[model samples]
Target chain A: MITFLFYLPFILGFVVIGVWGERKIASFIQDRYGPMEVGPKGLLQTIADLLKMLQKEDIRPKAADKPLFLMAPLLIFVAIFAGFAVLPISPAISGADIETGVFFLLAVVSLDVVGVLMAGWGSNNKYSLYGAMRSVAQIVSYEIPLGITVLCMVVIGSTLDLNELSSLQGIFTSETTYLFGIKSLGIDVTQIGGILSWNIVQVPFSFLIFLIFFIAGLAEANRAPFDLPESESELIGGYHTEYAGFRWGIFMLSEYAMMLLVSFLASILFFGGWNTPFPNIGSVTMATWTSGTPGELSGAIWGAFWLIFKTTIFVFVQMWVRWTYPRLRVDQLMSLSWKYLTPAALILLLLCGVWKMLMV
Target chain B: MDQMAVYLFYFFGLLAIAGALGILITRNLMHAAFLLIAVFLSVAAIFVLGGAEFVAVSQIMVYVGGILILLIFGIMLTNRISSDKIDTGFGNVLLGILVGCAFLVWVGDYILTQFNDQKAALEQTNNQTEKLGISLIADHVLAFELIAILLLIALIGAAYIAKKDKEEVME
Candidate 1:
């Protein structure tokens, strides 16, 4: 009982904070003041939105499948909330903290697609059906690349444990190299000469895989540029044309939650999870930042601060991409996934697995 | 908490079985696909209970993310079945249920006789990555390579077929 109560506020805080963060990100990229009209630089904009959503009438068209219409919103919210339940914010600060954290996170997040399909079906509209079908096809193809790329990370990390992997990245040794080899210029630099070594520096090809995965992830998450399900111009809000009030709110919230989840994943996979950037400064010199204090309400909350900072960078980039790029047609989306990302991801995965084996 | 978890699992399990039956027996392809999602979700819950987290994740990714989408695409492209109704005979339902029940019983009996003894003693464990992965590379290597080949073939075939279909439909 205490645990559930303890976690609820944090969850709400995360959702509220996400809106603020998004506004901040928007402003930073576009050079315009965003959301200042709300409260104290739009800090309470999320709250106002919540209130507006609450007061708005829950509208369902007479043609809508009433039962499914009601259930779809709950399903979307539940799957996303379930996704967050497994994402660790800090050391000892996770909801579930299961050994297979990544798997749970992946599974719970992917379930979002089912609810989208249901929403489309229940509406019984043509655009809804088109949106739903496109969504299905898009997700199906992109998921292959997403899975393979994550599998490559699992190959590198040697464990599905997010914490373990992050901690491994915390190893700031100057001598460590990717696959324990110096085959970059056929000169064996570490053995022959001396130089700096990082995973990004050593296994540059795998890092290239990570970039592909990140873009593919952006597509997979169905954010802007890939948000065919809600392409307002084309499909008039796409699959969710009929949704109003809280049901619509739920759909919107699910999307933002997924956005945060993916950004956090990027952090864990590429930016060393909650671990700091300077490997040497993780635990010792960064005591002020690494402490497990909750709501210290301080100038610098290290663990949460670093994690959020890394996540913010990813989120900002996501928003930048969203604003800058034009949406791809359904055929283009399909071709991009099947023709390019999937094969590339598979090859990268194979290379990494072989690299790890040879290193061992 | 243990009792509550068990009860929750059982409730979902029952729902899964009912959904699976609906999926198998229903004539409407769309409804069956939705019901199959329910079955998949329930089975994922079972995987969670069994501590097979990676398996549960793969189940969602492969089954929901892959097969269900394929099923939907199939329904969309097919011309024979009208969206209004799919006529399934009552005889087929009865026969399907009976055969399904028999298969279930046989599988149950085999599970009980063959694995019950060992399963009782063995405890639920975590970290299946190494074992499952080893099998993927060692035992399922041929199948893995074949999947690659199959995907390549399917890619080419889908392109060719969809191209023809596009021309026909455009005409």
Candidate 2:
């Protein structure tokens, strides 16, 4: 409960920053200035927008189901917030350090779909319904590949605990003991930990797994070009079409929060959660800084700092892709997952299984 | 911890019953689908209280997340929003209520009678996932393999059903 309270504000604060960063990145991609007046480089633009949303009149469609309509956004918010409960910002800072952390994370994150469906249904709008349906298909289809990739990581890591995964990628001393003699491959020159100890680098076929996972993560988060669910040219505003004011803001908040959550998971699984990429080569105490010692305040602080740093990079990439690519058609989106990603993930899973056997 | 578990069981048990009642009484089919989600979630809570965390998460992921979304799709895609009522008719409704009551009473009686006599030991292991994985690979390998094949066949059948026929394409 204490961990949840600590992360609640931390997550909200990050969401605000993420909103501003997304706009700035979108503008930068299109060669324009994004929200420069609200604060320095429009830093406070999200705050201004939040106030504006609060002041706007909350409107409900006459035909809408009143209770479900009112509850939809709150449900979405809660689903994302619940997902945060399992995510470890630092080794010592997590809401629930349950053994089924990964499974629980995936389960809670998938709950967002229910909220989206409810929003679309309760709104009683055709476009909203269409958007919801598309979203359901996309999320469900992409989830298989996303899950496979996560399983790939889990198989390599040999643990489902997020905190343990983080510790396994420590700056100086990582979990090379379980590398199944793959550490003798000579690619990992510096045994004294760094990027080489990261899952994407250490685990066999992990590069491909990371690629597939990243793309699937993008789809699951409904980021463009896979944003068929809400493609403005086609579906108006998608499931949140009938939503307005703070209700609409809640949807936006959930979207960004989901994006961050996926990005953080990617970082935690692949890029080394809260572990500095630099090795302990000098007298700089990089090991001390990156280590997740439970009682050490510096370790906790730096651990969180690195985690946020890696997660931010992934979020930026997502934003860049969102602005750079044109949205995919629904058919193309379906084919991309079923035809390409699913087969690729399956093959990769098989190959990784073989690789693990060899290492063992 | 035992007290907490007992309280949680009562809470989720009531929640599950309430969800079932909601499903029965709700006029809207969409609302009933949502209520089914509630029932699924409460059942998952029960599984968690029993220390089957993997089963609880799987229940949520597969039933609540995956299958419930499909149910919602079925409801929405059929354009049944405005006409969401499930017409059981007067006689059928009474029969359904009577059957439901009788079934509940029988189950309650059975549980009450067997509760003390069948006080099975709780799981001593914390690593249920590892145990589950091992059993699936070792003792339950054949059943697991058969289930995999069955799922594959089901997938193929679904694809066959969904695909356009050659005659339709020619037309």
Candidate 3:
């Protein structure tokens, strides 16, 4: 119950601002003014939209499967929100610090596909079915590269615990590198905690893995460029064609929530999650910016701050990518995942393993 | 907590059984697919209750993620054969139900005979996944390697079949 209470406000606030940010950024990219009416700089526009969605009539198709149709959005919401249970915002402020946190997160998130399929099939619409079919294929295909790329990180860290993975990338602390026991690479080149200590920088070809993961994450979340599942140009609302009012709102909310989940995982896996980018300077205190002191309220605050900050950056990048790239054809999307990304990720996984064995 | 565990186990057990029944009764193939998810989720919960977090997660990932999606795809491709309903003759349905029930009773009798109430204590380990990983490479290496080899062959076979169909289309 406490977890639900905490997540309610967090997700609400994130979706509200994330929607606004996406629009504002989209308009900025096109050199047009975005929503400027509702609140200052159109900040309250999402709230107004939310109210409008709530008040609208909940319409159902006459031929649609009512139970599955109604339950799809709720199931998707539950599955996506359950992922938050294992994601550690701060050392002190996590939901559930399970041993299989990473695997559990992947498992819960994958359940969203079932909801998408349900929505697609229950609508009794051809467009909805096509959307659902595409979504399942896209999501299932991308999950391989996504899981293997995550395995790359797991192999490097030797742990599935998200918190442990995060702590392993502590700023400025160099991972011990053993060069065949002949002589240790004595110099601590990556001693400074920051981007340098991050797995993206620390491991060989990890930057490449990070990029593949990001691309796969975008496809998995059904974002634009891989948004064939909901390609508005082709299929009127994709799997959610028949949904209306609050149900549609829930779908959109879950989409953004999925975006946030992917970004959060990316930050945790590659970037120094909850760890400040600023390195410690002599006699200068920037302690508050880094990971918070565990068990301290101050620590949770900073931990939340850094984690959210890094996540927002990634979300912004996702929005940027969304507007920038044209949506891939369905064949192209499948080929990208299977032909390129899978093999690339496989090689990267092997490279990381070798790097760990030989260098560290 | 122990009582809660017992109740939770019963809850999931009933859910699993209910899901299986739903699958058996549902005429709609898609509905059965969805019901199968409930069975998978309940089984995963049972695994979690048994202190096998890794197994529980892998259960969700593999069964829910890979297998269910493939099953749905299979159903979709066979839509022309039967889209709305999968009708069976009444006599056949009754026969199928009777056979299913007989099998269930046999399984129950076996469980009753073989089950042990004196279970081993839960291991005090923070990271069961680490132990699992080590064992997979150590004691279970052959089985693991064989599974990998099987999957590789299956992948190759699938690719070859798909490619042949594409070539036929082109010709």
Instruction: Provide the TM-score of chain A alone for each candidate, in the order shown.
Output: 0.82, 0.93, 0.94
User: Candidate 2, residues A221-300: lDDT per residue as tens digits?
Assistant: 99998898888888998899999898998898888888888998999999889777876555765555466465478767
| lDDT per residue as tens, model 3, B9-89 | 999999999999998777777788889999999999998888888999999999998899889878877776215654432
> What does candidate 3's lDDT look like per residue over A46-104, in tens digits?
99999989999999998888889999999998999888887777765656868888889
Q: What is the lDDT of residue A149 in candidate 1?
A: 84
Off by over 4 Å in 3: A171-183, A189-191, A285-292, B81-102, B121-124, B165-169
Q: Write out fnat for all predictions, comma-separated.
A: 0.47, 0.66, 0.78
Q: Which ten residues in a row have the lowest lDDT in candidate 3 chain A?
A: A174-183
TM-score of chain B of each: 0.74, 0.85, 0.85
Of the two candidates 1 and 3, the one with more favorable DockQ, higher being better, is 3
Q: How many pairs of residues collide in each model? A: 1, 0, 4
**What are the models' TM-scores?**
0.82, 0.94, 0.94
Candidate lDDT values, in order: 0.70, 0.82, 0.84
The better-scoring model by lDDT among 2 and 3 is 3
Model 2: what TM-score for its first chain?
0.93
* TM-score between candidate 3 and the true structure: 0.94
lDDT of 1 at A179: 30
